[model samples]
Target chain A: MHADSTTTRKAAALAAFAGLDREPGVAKPDPILVVDNVVRRFGGLTAVDVAHLEIQRGSITALIGPNGAGKTTFFNQLTGFDSADEGSWAFNGKQLKGVPAHRVARTGMVRTFQLTKALSKLTVMENMRLGAQNQRGENFFRALVPGSWRQQEDEITERAEELLERFKLNTKRDDFAGSLSGGQRKLLEMARALMVGPELVMLDEPMAGVNPALTQSLLAHVKDLREEGMTVLFVEHDMDMVRDISDWVVVMAQGAVIAEGPPDTIMSDQRVVDAYLGAHHDAPMSAEEFEEQLQEAEAELEAEIEEKA
Target chain B: MDWNAILITTVKASIGLETVVYALAAIGVNIQFGYAGLLNFGQAAFLGVAAYGMAVTVATFHLPFWLGIAIGLAATVVLAFLLGIPTLRLRADYLAIVTIAAAEIVRLVFRSVKFSSVFGGSDGRQNFSGDFFAMNPYSPGTYGIGPISFNERVTWILTVGWVLIAICCGLVYLLMKSPWGRVLKAIREDEDAVRSLGKNVFSYKMQALVLGGLVGCLGGFLFALGQASVQPDLFSTEFTFYAYTIVILGGAARVFSPVVGAAIFWVLLVFVGNTLSEAVSAGMLPSLFTVNNIGAVRFMLVGLGLMLLLIFRPQGIFGDKREIALDAR
Candidate 1:
């Protein structure tokens, strides 16, 4: 499927997302989501305090942070899963300040949870069908008249089957979602999200609980989303996976964006290191020890990622 | 010592008036608790309010039978709204608590002496069923085969009751298979998940509450019309509990489960009671168990059977085990 023309288009999209990665809180030429002054507080603790951020259209961005950096909280605020104490944002230039979570999804900004929220009691195919947009059968009155929605339901089933096949979950279509393995649930969640044909898909820790064997495939699927000309934003902890697939990296620490750059630059940036290690800015390590610690941190991160994978 | 009489009575009880009444109530519970995962412990309130609405409308206002039916239905819808608006958004247990309390309040209000003039107080209202029986087409004659029979009045009630049951079952079957039904099941599994998928979860829940409550009101109508009287004490919390037991016995989330369950429940209850009483009369047991104690003993057996069913198969007879793993939070 990697034809010559498609490779050029992928490269073109990659180039467009380049350079802007180096600037913190930078403006994008073609932004799909723009957030300003978004803050969420729980009691006295402020969980997220994003001042300004823009996600470029048709790019794969990674939101990476330590355990308590509030990446997921920020994701929740952006997607309307939770309300912000003070904020305003837009998706494709449509103001989404007070929009509900479902409406946010309707605007082509679909999201999946860190822990997969597959309807465990529902069959795999049913879970996929639930993801489809504007289903006629979902209407209360229209649902009773089969003639009004049967054809639409059939079409939805067909689309769901196609996605199941793509996700390699076709054989398990009749099985309850709860019966699937952890990795399969994650795959099913991603596949289900695509049933909306969304322009922007935000996944929270897609590979968190996946097996290593499936993590590679999950990574490939994330890359394929961008290849299909869709914008992908994911919150992840694994540096290797982020470096492997992310076009740009946005670092968060203490609930604020500390740096934005390409994977290589972000990995080497001093602030990113301090954010991860909690090291003081004035206490620079010796060259040899610094390199060793960096390698040690990467290895430790890899082991942790593998355990979850 | 007629074993023949006992067996016949048990068979008749399986398809008797009580079965029809409980079946109607359980089917409504199926929609709320089974399909939507709603904890509607006030199902009796729906039946009570509807029954009282019909009784008060006709006996107090001296209105026509048709008008009373309309008022009964309207009252059920209003009761659903009144109960749902304050509790639907809360956790599942809150709904359970609220509904049970609401049912008790309704029963107490109806039985209170303050409304004795209008509601007939503890005696409840009678004579309102005259119009219903008048509309009955059956002539004055006994119906059915030897050993099992019904008079014209009962025959008419059975005909109407069975027809209503069929219609309600058909409606549930159609709705559960539709996309709207899919959403209800999804809400049962995870309301947040459905909401995140762009569905108005709260609205769907309210609709299910109203629909189920409305369907349950049919049982109220059948209870009053078949007995030819409406009593406040008849619609107690135990009434709702019995309906729940019927729903669970039939295997929840299945359309025909409630019907089958109600039949089996009444049959078993009557069968056990008859057999025990006969055994006691025949001197087959000790003097500690008298015939009058048979009623309580029969319920104990049913309770035991239910516990066994839950332990061995928590999903009931026809239900998928996964369906009962409710995300009630």
Candidate 2:
């Protein structure tokens, strides 16, 4: 009976994510967020100029690109950290144009920074408590009267403790976030974002400075987020991590989306290769081979110079 | 040379009216700069507006003393709102620039001959504190031990001021331990992080401004009542800087740091000034150090002390250094 029930649950989970693993920008049966003609400009540079994009519900989507490809910039605009010059987008079918960053989080779409802002002066537990929504203790007058929010404060503490344990950070809960290692701070940030109970969590370069030892655990956490019925949109440069966990991938280059597909197809996409490897796509196999070829050319040029002298 | 007299006076100055006044002001600065990480260089304006509010209302407009006090607090709140609306959204330095300029404007307006009819211009106003002194419950006598004694009036003001300080400290302690205070600290460290967690950063900053301004305004009431007068020059930009010094000296972000800092600051000022004056009179020091020069010398010594403290221990006496290592960006 137990085995039958497990198989049934697995079948249901597979059905839910079936069509979402298709080509990116292809309309999902139930998309949690949709973007159209969103553009952002900084001085003379157009940082993000995404024409159209859609994030599938309950699927892990990777936004992969080379550096300066405007991946982070596009995330900022979508999450309301920065405003778009024009165009609009919707999350859960609600328009998000001109919404403030805090309001966007309140509307069940929260984002984590690429640099991992961990409220350095605050304790990890305090940072987690700050993430919980609508605490009575946040009210000025109520804050003075502890009894007014004591019960709710207890609830938030319990929740924060649970999240800390889940992220294996309960040991460091009392320590100041500034004292944490880079990877630990990234974990704290992710755990803090989860405290909001967000439907859509946007991660900006989750593995930027993380060690290889922690990368597997972080990847597992991202996949677990999808299993827990939350949609994730992440910006990453590691193609291995993208292929390992991402259901769909969106490739950006020079402030625009160049290609979108499942990770396997995206790896072979010519535009993505050109954007990443450039015109030297047919370069030598290894560093030693390339160095040998450079030496041969240099020897020929030196011989010509010697003969002229 | 009455060295004993100088020692007694220095001891008295440690807990005197000036100490209480600056301590109260520094507590407000603690909220703005220490906790919220706001750079408010116009804290003296809050005190100034309140003092003038009471002075104009009671002495010039013939209003009741209580009504004057109420109007004074309301005016401080209004000033906080007015200042916060335009500058809170900008960078921290913009608030500092605007606040210093706004404070100067307030002082100039109070000093201007155009407002002499209401503000009394540079000469200032008096007789507004009579009602407050009339309400003093203490008997008419000197109160205290030895040379530290105070008259009934001074005793009454000291009692009320210290009580207010205690209450304000308790309020701050309770608030800082709450979730709201957590958000303020987070904002101080990284506002973008707090905002990303669904906090209204602007609203929190504005609330902090109003709360700190209101607390600072209480210092103005005490000043006006203690002296029975209000002058435009008394609320100069130097007053705010003095408050900042006290906040840092006591340790920023700690509740009782300002109170202790204010006491130490006044004691040091009085001690240095008295010692230098006595030395000058006794011809123990060079003739260049006249009694009149003691004031400047005392301030210079305190300034030097502050610089050294910042270099060696930027967190002050009781503060954790991390609290003041703000990420204003």
Candidate 3:
């Protein structure tokens, strides 16, 4: 009933990392986040089990891995989307165990999803409203009587309009979110997330489906996120983009970290190459390749049947 | 009937039990569906629950009318939270499915054999309107000239109900224009984006759900007070269905959409039904059609009309399509 393979992958990764505990309770000074013995699991599938992971303060960190390397799973666990089977993490020294997704978000550890979840029916302006903030009017009792809540409402509208203008979505404010192109939706999603002014912005994949033209804009936005004193954590497949922006990189394969360092070091690590790059783990096999392999196996079976006959 | 008589009658009928009730429910739904993007198909349950809440408190517990009102509103909020907790995080359709089922279940519980003693069984509870009528400003007489006349008690209820509608609509307008309203609209548009901004998507949803449910519950209070009665069958799925029709008919996200929709919808229903019945009875039309069949036939015609409207203009009278989305997905 649930696609929780993510949970299992994280658990296995955490266990494996625990076994390689050459490092102690030690961490780099001024770490923004520390994941200690974080284990997440699905039924019979260990997805991410990170014994120790530290996010450097105010630096852009990229978590990279093959398709099933538990990168997204780990992201889920770290951000409170999924609870760790066994682990504890902290944001700005506040323990983030058993914290629900929203509570964690309230604490400034915000995250964007891989697939965009733009509310398609609302106008771009309405979408901005949704991203605005808590107001007295949000309460039904307070929804009435404008005098008590109008000033606050005005502030939210002003803020939303400012952000929409900055993101170049001002003209489209009256347009339905569904009418926006894919890249525009991406921009809207990013801009909407910034409405809260988060300290850490965890982007699942800021450029997975982005076109070349919008790629630079997204990259610049990510840089801006860094410049604004917000930590950026993204899962990206574009090695070139990764090297260009990521201050540090952590690579994972088969639900565990294979390497962690700068993008250049991670790209060259033989373990990472064998698990992802050289083996083409990042790209799922095409339908044609799968069919060809199936045909070859069927042919071999037929030959064996003939011999038996 | 004369043309003026027909027009007057149509307005009177349209503004009666159906529109008054539906307008209230749509206001509640505006909070949920319009602002929060919660596709709650069981809005009638809020009405049903509140009706029963009032009934149970006043009739069964023998409590005062205002106390009954408090209990009803409280019960509605609790019901919204209960329904929201399990389903809010699920896909939109899941909530729809669960809410429809829940609404039916609430209706059944209100009418069930075990609880029939308190609920008055299928016969429903009457004599509950006495307290409301005690405050009626009108003496026993028809107030309006021509076909626009209303009995004293009925006139009183309409006045109160319309005032409530005005207040609710104004509230929606002001809130939606405010910052909090913007956040709700944003959540509707992009929850993940809101989530990344450190807003609690689920909490916002819960808030919207409860608030809307409470507002929807008000309709039930009005209905019970209006009729001086509470019945299980009155809270049928059609009640919620008609509310959605009103919301869509007037405009989904617009503040006054429910009011316009309720008025237009009731007017259409009354006009169509009366015209058909009169035509049939007076032998001005085919003999095959009967007054009884008018109920079913009118629905089909209305449905067809609605479908055409949706195809051509999903946004009703005053709505900008961008203001509200018809896409449940």
Give the whole-model CA lDDT for all candidates, comma-separated. 0.89, 0.89, 0.79
For residues A234-309, write the lDDT of model 1, one tens digit per residue: 9999999999988888999989998898886788888888988777666778999889989999999999999999
Give the CA lDDT, 0 to 100, for residue A276 in model 2. Answer: 91
* Root-mean-square deviation (CA) per prediction: 7.1, 6.4, 8.3
Candidate 2, superposed: residue stretches over 4 Å from native? A1-24, A278-309, B321-329
Task: List model 1 lDDT by residue over B16-135, tens digit each.
Answer: 889999999999999999999999999999999998899899998899989999999999999999989999887889999999999999999999999888888999999898899998
For model 3 the interface RMSD, in Å, equals 3.4
Q: Could you give the TM-score of chain B for each candidate, in order?
A: 0.96, 0.97, 0.94
- For model 1, the stretches where C-alpha displacement exceeds 4 angstroms are A1-6, A21-23, A281-309, B321-329
What lDDT does candidate 3 reach at residue A267?
72
lDDT of residue A257 for candidate 3 = 67
Q: Between the candidate structures 1 and 2, which one is better when assessed by TM-score?
A: 1
Q: What TM-score describes the B chain of model 2?
A: 0.97
Candidate 3, superposed: residue stretches over 4 Å from native: A1-29, A119-178, A277-309, B1-5, B59-62, B322-329
User: What's the DockQ for every one of the candidates?
Assistant: 0.49, 0.55, 0.36
Superposition error at B75 for model 2 (Å):
1.3
Ranking by TM-score: 1, 2, 3
lDDT of 2 by residue, B1-329 (tens): 66997999999998899999999999999999999999999999999999999989999999999999999999999999999999999889999999999999999999999999999999888989989999999999999997789999999999999999999999999999998898898888889998899999999999999999989999999998999999999999999999999998988789999999999899988888888888888889877888888889988987887789788987789988665553322
